[model samples]
Target: MAKARSAIVSSGPVGFLPVSITFFMAILMLLPIGSGASNIIMPHLVMISIFYWLSSRPLLMPYGACAVLGLCIDLWLNVPLGLNMLLLLLTRLFVLNQLKHYKGRNRAVHWGVFAVMSCGLYLISWILFSAIHSEFWPIKPVLMQWLVTAFSYAPVAFLLGRLRRWAW
Candidate 1:
Protein backbone atom coordinates (compact mmCIF):
# COMPACT_ATOMS: atom_id res chain seq x y z
CA MET A 1 0.00 0.00 0.00
CA ALA A 2 2.86 2.34 0.85
CA LYS A 3 4.53 1.45 -2.42
CA ALA A 4 1.27 2.13 -4.19
CA ARG A 5 0.97 5.48 -2.44
CA SER A 6 4.52 6.44 -3.35
CA ALA A 7 3.92 5.25 -6.88
CA ILE A 8 0.93 7.54 -7.14
CA VAL A 9 2.89 10.47 -5.75
CA SER A 10 5.93 9.82 -7.91
CA SER A 11 3.60 9.71 -10.88
CA GLY A 12 3.19 13.47 -10.75
CA PRO A 13 6.38 13.97 -12.72
CA VAL A 14 6.43 10.80 -14.79
CA GLY A 15 2.86 10.98 -15.92
CA PHE A 16 3.28 13.22 -18.93
CA LEU A 17 4.39 10.75 -21.59
CA PRO A 18 1.71 8.23 -20.78
CA VAL A 19 -0.86 10.99 -20.68
CA SER A 20 0.35 12.45 -23.95
CA ILE A 21 0.28 9.03 -25.54
CA THR A 22 -3.35 8.63 -24.61
CA PHE A 23 -4.03 12.08 -25.97
CA PHE A 24 -2.41 11.22 -29.28
CA MET A 25 -4.40 8.03 -29.45
CA ALA A 26 -7.58 9.82 -28.54
CA ILE A 27 -7.01 12.28 -31.33
CA LEU A 28 -6.16 9.51 -33.70
CA MET A 29 -9.32 7.61 -32.89
CA LEU A 30 -11.79 10.44 -32.57
CA LEU A 31 -10.78 12.51 -35.54
CA PRO A 32 -12.39 11.45 -38.81
CA ILE A 33 -10.46 13.93 -40.91
CA GLY A 34 -8.33 11.29 -42.60
CA SER A 35 -11.08 8.71 -42.78
CA GLY A 36 -12.66 9.22 -46.22
CA ALA A 37 -9.85 11.28 -47.70
CA SER A 38 -7.00 8.92 -46.75
CA ASN A 39 -6.03 5.82 -44.83
CA ILE A 40 -2.73 5.49 -42.96
CA ILE A 41 -1.34 2.00 -43.23
CA MET A 42 1.24 2.25 -40.48
CA PRO A 43 0.19 2.99 -36.95
CA HIS A 44 2.65 5.89 -36.61
CA LEU A 45 1.40 7.42 -33.40
CA VAL A 46 1.88 4.16 -31.53
CA MET A 47 5.19 3.57 -33.22
CA ILE A 48 6.49 7.02 -32.38
CA SER A 49 5.36 6.76 -28.79
CA ILE A 50 7.09 3.41 -28.45
CA PHE A 51 10.22 4.81 -30.02
CA TYR A 52 10.24 7.77 -27.62
CA TRP A 53 10.25 5.64 -24.49
CA LEU A 54 12.59 3.07 -25.98
CA SER A 55 15.13 5.78 -26.66
CA SER A 56 14.61 7.84 -23.54
CA ARG A 57 14.30 5.30 -20.75
CA PRO A 58 14.67 1.64 -21.62
CA LEU A 59 14.99 0.55 -17.99
CA LEU A 60 11.79 2.12 -16.66
CA MET A 61 9.96 1.30 -19.89
CA PRO A 62 10.70 -2.31 -20.65
CA TYR A 63 9.80 -4.56 -23.57
CA GLY A 64 6.97 -5.84 -21.40
CA ALA A 65 5.68 -2.33 -21.19
CA CYS A 66 6.02 -2.01 -24.92
CA ALA A 67 4.20 -5.28 -25.42
CA VAL A 68 1.39 -4.25 -23.13
CA LEU A 69 1.14 -0.86 -24.71
CA GLY A 70 1.04 -2.46 -28.13
CA LEU A 71 -1.70 -4.76 -26.96
CA CYS A 72 -3.62 -1.81 -25.58
CA ILE A 73 -3.22 -0.17 -28.96
CA ASP A 74 -4.61 -3.27 -30.59
CA LEU A 75 -7.49 -3.43 -28.18
CA TRP A 76 -8.24 0.26 -28.15
CA LEU A 77 -7.76 0.82 -31.86
CA ASN A 78 -9.14 -2.59 -32.78
CA VAL A 79 -6.25 -3.73 -34.87
CA PRO A 80 -4.89 -7.26 -35.03
CA LEU A 81 -3.56 -8.44 -31.69
CA GLY A 82 -0.09 -9.67 -32.49
CA LEU A 83 0.45 -7.18 -35.26
CA ASN A 84 1.37 -4.37 -32.88
CA MET A 85 3.18 -6.82 -30.66
CA LEU A 86 5.32 -7.65 -33.65
CA LEU A 87 5.82 -3.99 -34.45
CA LEU A 88 6.83 -3.22 -30.89
CA LEU A 89 9.20 -6.17 -30.88
CA LEU A 90 10.77 -5.06 -34.12
CA THR A 91 10.98 -1.47 -32.83
CA ARG A 92 12.78 -2.60 -29.70
CA LEU A 93 15.14 -4.64 -31.84
CA PHE A 94 15.72 -1.74 -34.19
CA VAL A 95 16.60 0.60 -31.34
CA LEU A 96 18.76 -2.04 -29.68
CA ASN A 97 20.69 -2.59 -32.89
CA GLN A 98 21.39 1.12 -33.14
CA LEU A 99 22.39 1.56 -29.51
CA LYS A 100 25.95 2.55 -30.38
CA HIS A 101 24.70 5.11 -32.87
CA TYR A 102 22.59 6.73 -30.16
CA LYS A 103 24.74 6.50 -27.03
CA GLY A 104 27.43 8.85 -28.33
CA ARG A 105 25.26 11.61 -29.71
CA ASN A 106 23.64 14.87 -28.57
CA ARG A 107 19.94 14.70 -27.80
CA ALA A 108 19.00 16.55 -30.96
CA VAL A 109 20.88 14.13 -33.15
CA HIS A 110 19.46 11.30 -31.15
CA TRP A 111 15.84 12.41 -31.53
CA GLY A 112 16.42 13.31 -35.15
CA VAL A 113 17.71 9.86 -35.81
CA PHE A 114 14.82 8.49 -33.83
CA ALA A 115 12.40 10.30 -36.10
CA VAL A 116 14.13 9.13 -39.25
CA MET A 117 14.40 5.59 -38.06
CA SER A 118 10.81 5.53 -36.93
CA CYS A 119 9.75 6.77 -40.34
CA GLY A 120 11.82 4.12 -42.06
CA LEU A 121 10.57 1.39 -39.77
CA TYR A 122 7.02 2.49 -40.41
CA LEU A 123 7.65 2.14 -44.12
CA ILE A 124 9.14 -1.28 -43.76
CA SER A 125 6.38 -2.27 -41.38
CA TRP A 126 3.80 -1.10 -43.86
CA ILE A 127 5.36 -3.23 -46.54
CA LEU A 128 5.62 -6.28 -44.35
CA PHE A 129 2.11 -5.89 -43.06
CA SER A 130 0.75 -5.39 -46.54
CA ALA A 131 2.65 -8.39 -47.77
CA ILE A 132 1.41 -10.47 -44.91
CA HIS A 133 -2.11 -9.35 -45.59
CA SER A 134 -1.56 -9.71 -49.34
CA GLU A 135 -2.47 -6.14 -50.26
CA PHE A 136 -1.00 -2.68 -50.59
CA TRP A 137 -3.16 -0.33 -48.54
CA PRO A 138 -1.98 2.98 -50.10
CA ILE A 139 0.99 5.30 -50.19
CA LYS A 140 -0.52 8.73 -49.71
CA PRO A 141 -2.03 8.03 -46.32
CA VAL A 142 1.10 6.41 -44.99
CA LEU A 143 3.12 9.35 -46.19
CA MET A 144 0.72 11.74 -44.51
CA GLN A 145 1.02 9.78 -41.29
CA TRP A 146 4.76 9.98 -41.62
CA LEU A 147 4.55 13.73 -41.93
CA VAL A 148 2.24 14.11 -38.93
CA THR A 149 4.23 11.66 -36.81
CA ALA A 150 7.49 13.37 -37.72
CA PHE A 151 5.89 16.65 -36.83
CA SER A 152 4.97 15.19 -33.43
CA TYR A 153 8.51 13.92 -32.95
CA ALA A 154 10.04 17.26 -32.02
CA PRO A 155 7.67 18.23 -29.24
CA VAL A 156 7.55 14.76 -27.75
CA ALA A 157 11.31 14.63 -27.95
CA PHE A 158 11.66 18.00 -26.31
CA LEU A 159 9.53 16.78 -23.46
CA LEU A 160 11.41 13.53 -23.19
CA GLY A 161 14.73 15.35 -23.26
CA ARG A 162 13.60 17.48 -20.37
CA LEU A 163 12.62 14.36 -18.44
CA ARG A 164 15.82 12.47 -19.34
CA ARG A 165 17.67 13.17 -16.13
CA TRP A 166 14.59 12.34 -14.13
CA ALA A 167 14.24 8.97 -15.88
CA TRP A 168 17.23 7.55 -14.12
Candidate 2:
Protein backbone atom coordinates (compact mmCIF):
# COMPACT_ATOMS: atom_id res chain seq x y z
CA MET A 1 0.00 0.00 0.00
CA ALA A 2 2.76 2.42 0.86
CA LYS A 3 4.55 1.64 -2.40
CA ALA A 4 1.37 2.27 -4.38
CA ARG A 5 0.80 5.56 -2.59
CA SER A 6 4.36 6.62 -3.36
CA ALA A 7 3.93 5.77 -6.98
CA ILE A 8 0.73 7.79 -7.20
CA VAL A 9 2.35 10.78 -5.54
CA SER A 10 5.37 10.58 -7.78
CA SER A 11 3.22 10.62 -10.86
CA GLY A 12 1.15 13.58 -9.77
CA PRO A 13 1.58 16.97 -11.40
CA VAL A 14 4.36 19.25 -10.33
CA GLY A 15 3.39 22.89 -9.81
CA PHE A 16 6.55 24.46 -11.22
CA LEU A 17 6.75 22.47 -14.44
CA PRO A 18 4.10 24.42 -16.33
CA VAL A 19 5.19 27.89 -15.33
CA SER A 20 8.89 27.25 -15.82
CA ILE A 21 8.46 25.57 -19.17
CA THR A 22 6.16 28.29 -20.43
CA PHE A 23 8.51 31.01 -19.30
CA PHE A 24 11.49 29.23 -20.82
CA MET A 25 9.75 28.81 -24.13
CA ALA A 26 8.63 32.43 -24.10
CA ILE A 27 12.20 33.52 -23.61
CA LEU A 28 13.33 31.22 -26.38
CA MET A 29 10.76 32.71 -28.71
CA LEU A 30 12.36 36.09 -28.17
CA LEU A 31 15.81 34.88 -29.18
CA PRO A 32 17.00 35.71 -32.67
CA ILE A 33 17.32 32.87 -35.15
CA GLY A 34 20.59 34.38 -36.43
CA SER A 35 19.49 33.68 -39.99
CA GLY A 36 18.63 37.33 -40.60
CA ALA A 37 15.07 36.33 -41.42
CA SER A 38 12.30 38.72 -40.63
CA ASN A 39 10.71 38.50 -37.20
CA ILE A 40 7.45 37.45 -38.81
CA ILE A 41 8.90 34.05 -39.59
CA MET A 42 9.69 33.35 -35.98
CA PRO A 43 7.46 30.68 -34.52
CA HIS A 44 5.37 31.40 -31.47
CA LEU A 45 7.05 28.88 -29.24
CA VAL A 46 5.27 30.08 -26.16
CA MET A 47 1.86 29.40 -27.66
CA ILE A 48 2.89 25.86 -28.50
CA SER A 49 4.06 25.28 -24.98
CA ILE A 50 0.86 26.71 -23.54
CA PHE A 51 -1.31 24.51 -25.70
CA TYR A 52 0.71 21.39 -24.89
CA TRP A 53 0.56 21.91 -21.16
CA LEU A 54 -3.06 22.99 -21.09
CA SER A 55 -4.08 19.94 -23.07
CA SER A 56 -2.04 17.48 -21.07
CA ARG A 57 -2.30 18.94 -17.58
CA PRO A 58 -4.82 21.72 -17.31
CA LEU A 59 -4.70 21.87 -13.54
CA LEU A 60 -0.96 22.47 -13.61
CA MET A 61 -1.38 25.61 -15.71
CA PRO A 62 -4.09 27.88 -14.45
CA TYR A 63 -5.58 30.73 -16.50
CA GLY A 64 -3.85 33.32 -14.34
CA ALA A 65 -0.51 31.70 -15.02
CA CYS A 66 -1.19 31.83 -18.72
CA ALA A 67 -1.98 35.52 -18.46
CA VAL A 68 1.20 36.15 -16.59
CA LEU A 69 3.25 34.32 -19.16
CA GLY A 70 1.53 36.30 -21.90
CA LEU A 71 2.40 39.53 -20.20
CA CYS A 72 5.98 38.43 -20.00
CA ILE A 73 6.04 37.67 -23.69
CA ASP A 74 4.41 40.98 -24.56
CA LEU A 75 6.96 42.87 -22.54
CA TRP A 76 9.83 40.83 -23.91
CA LEU A 77 8.75 41.30 -27.50
CA ASN A 78 7.90 44.98 -26.95
CA VAL A 79 4.42 44.49 -28.29
CA PRO A 80 1.44 46.39 -26.92
CA LEU A 81 0.72 45.47 -23.34
CA GLY A 82 -2.13 43.03 -22.71
CA LEU A 83 -2.14 41.78 -26.29
CA ASN A 84 -0.54 38.45 -25.49
CA MET A 85 -2.40 38.31 -22.20
CA LEU A 86 -5.79 38.34 -23.87
CA LEU A 87 -4.75 35.91 -26.57
CA LEU A 88 -3.18 33.45 -24.16
CA LEU A 89 -6.22 33.58 -21.90
CA LEU A 90 -8.50 32.90 -24.83
CA THR A 91 -6.29 30.04 -26.02
CA ARG A 92 -6.32 28.48 -22.59
CA LEU A 93 -10.10 28.69 -22.42
CA PHE A 94 -10.46 27.23 -25.88
CA VAL A 95 -8.18 24.30 -25.13
CA LEU A 96 -9.85 23.60 -21.79
CA ASN A 97 -13.22 23.45 -23.48
CA GLN A 98 -11.95 21.14 -26.21
CA LEU A 99 -9.71 18.97 -24.04
CA LYS A 100 -12.41 16.39 -23.40
CA HIS A 101 -12.76 15.63 -27.09
CA TYR A 102 -9.00 15.35 -27.34
CA LYS A 103 -8.56 12.87 -24.52
CA GLY A 104 -8.79 9.69 -26.55
CA ARG A 105 -7.88 11.14 -29.92
CA ASN A 106 -4.71 10.44 -31.83
CA ARG A 107 -1.81 12.84 -32.23
CA ALA A 108 -2.93 13.69 -35.74
CA VAL A 109 -6.22 14.93 -34.35
CA HIS A 110 -4.39 17.13 -31.89
CA TRP A 111 -2.22 18.57 -34.65
CA GLY A 112 -5.24 19.32 -36.80
CA VAL A 113 -6.95 21.11 -33.94
CA PHE A 114 -3.77 23.04 -33.19
CA ALA A 115 -3.54 24.15 -36.80
CA VAL A 116 -7.08 25.48 -36.59
CA MET A 117 -6.34 27.27 -33.36
CA SER A 118 -3.16 28.75 -34.82
CA CYS A 119 -5.17 30.16 -37.73
CA GLY A 120 -7.61 31.82 -35.40
CA LEU A 121 -4.78 33.18 -33.29
CA TYR A 122 -3.07 34.77 -36.27
CA LEU A 123 -6.30 36.26 -37.54
CA ILE A 124 -7.18 37.76 -34.18
CA SER A 125 -3.67 39.08 -33.74
CA TRP A 126 -3.72 40.78 -37.10
CA ILE A 127 -7.05 42.38 -36.36
CA LEU A 128 -5.92 43.56 -32.97
CA PHE A 129 -2.70 44.98 -34.35
CA SER A 130 -4.55 46.82 -37.10
CA ALA A 131 -6.96 48.21 -34.59
CA ILE A 132 -4.15 49.39 -32.33
CA HIS A 133 -2.15 50.97 -35.15
CA SER A 134 -5.11 52.38 -37.06
CA GLU A 135 -3.73 50.87 -40.25
CA PHE A 136 -4.03 47.56 -41.96
CA TRP A 137 -0.71 45.83 -41.54
CA PRO A 138 0.56 43.56 -44.25
CA ILE A 139 -1.02 40.11 -44.06
CA LYS A 140 2.11 38.37 -45.30
CA PRO A 141 3.86 38.43 -41.95
CA VAL A 142 0.87 36.99 -40.15
CA LEU A 143 0.62 34.26 -42.70
CA MET A 144 4.27 33.45 -42.33
CA GLN A 145 3.93 33.34 -38.58
CA TRP A 146 1.00 30.98 -38.85
CA LEU A 147 2.82 28.68 -41.19
CA VAL A 148 5.96 28.55 -39.12
CA THR A 149 4.02 28.02 -35.91
CA ALA A 150 1.96 25.22 -37.42
CA PHE A 151 4.96 23.39 -38.82
CA SER A 152 6.94 23.77 -35.63
CA TYR A 153 4.18 22.19 -33.54
CA ALA A 154 5.25 18.62 -34.12
CA PRO A 155 8.72 18.92 -32.63
CA VAL A 156 7.55 21.16 -29.83
CA ALA A 157 4.79 18.72 -28.94
CA PHE A 158 7.22 15.85 -28.99
CA LEU A 159 9.62 17.57 -26.62
CA LEU A 160 6.85 18.69 -24.34
CA GLY A 161 5.39 15.22 -24.32
CA ARG A 162 8.69 13.86 -23.14
CA LEU A 163 8.81 16.45 -20.42
CA ARG A 164 5.25 15.67 -19.39
CA ARG A 165 5.97 11.99 -19.11
CA TRP A 166 9.07 12.69 -17.10
CA ALA A 167 7.23 15.01 -14.79
CA TRP A 168 4.40 12.63 -14.20
Give the best candidate by TM-score: 2
Off by over 4 Å in 1: 1-43, 163-168
Q: How far is candidate 1 from the true structure (C-alpha RMSD, Å)?
A: 5.6
Q: What is candidate 1's lDDT per residue for 25-65, written digit by digit as tens?
A: 54574454546556534335566666766665454446776
Off by over 4 Å in 2: 1-13, 37-40
Q: Which ten residues in a row have the lowest lDDT in candidate 2?
A: 5-14
Give the range where candidate 1 is weakest over 10 consecutive residues by summed lDDT: 14-23
In model 2, the clashing pairs are: none
- For candidate 2, lDDT tens digit of each residue in 28-123? 888777665643466888889889888876777788899898998888889999999988998899998899988768888888889999899889
lDDT at 141, model 2: 82
